[model samples]
Target: MTDEMNNAQEWQARAESAEAALSRVQAEVDARLIRAELKAEALRAGMVDLDGLKLLDTEDLRLTEAGDVADAPALLARLKRAKPWLFGVAMSSSSAANPPRPEPPRTRHANDLSHEEWLAARAVLLRRR
Candidate 1:
């Protein structure tokens, strides 16, 4: 009930509020640091987009950091299992830089075998396999 005791209680409340704010700010800073670290790791592993890792959840990021994942490729493999949208339809590196080789057209030979011979040859191939 004393004035000094009342002031002491108010100060204690103020200290707790400050501590909570500090903890919140620290958490935000730590999150930013983690995102930056993940981006660096992705770049080192030759990933094209570091921001993709930034889109991952905290738990996913924590698991990546804790798991036996070796590089961004491995991390991406796991993330793809959960978020297939991260990667659009897969494409072989046959982009315009290295145009895709046109597949050779299949054709019957000039000295073609009859159906019976072809059947026998197919059976032989299957057995060989």
Candidate 2:
């Protein structure tokens, strides 16, 4: 029937709209992440030496150019021998930057005192004044 055909077209339109919205949101997220990385890099400059050991991000550890993995073990051995934290700055910065996780939602219990009970408690304090 024509009615069924119209309903199918409407559903298809809605699906296309949803996909477009998702793409826009993903683009925005990518832009934000790029900005954060740039800011972090600027903050790290001058303080670390790129020649001796490539500065990563927050912590001090160098990485080999061949692969993404940090040359942490060699750096750690050096740190153990030097014990440079005594001076204030730790020599190397961490190569990996971790994104923050979203916070969990708060929970409420019905057995907990209702909103009316809170108002009553406030009233009792006002009466004493």
Candidate 2 per-residue lDDT over residues 1-129, each given as its tens digit:
999999999999999999999999976665555444433443343223222233223243232354222544444345335543322355356747666789888664545758897677779979999
**Cα error, candidate 2, residue 28 (Å):** 0.4
How would you encode candidate 1's per-residue C-alpha lDDT over 1-129 as one tens digit per residue? Answer: 699999999999999999999999977766666666666665654456556786666554432444333354566667667666655565767666766699998787636989888888889989998
Model 1 misplacement above 4 A: 59-77, 80-129
TM-score of each: 0.49, 0.36
Off by over 4 Å in 2: 47-129
Clashes (N, CA, C under 3 Å) per candidate: 0, 6
Please list all clashing residue pairs in model 2, or write none if there are none.
59-93, 59-94, 60-92, 60-93, 60-94, 61-93
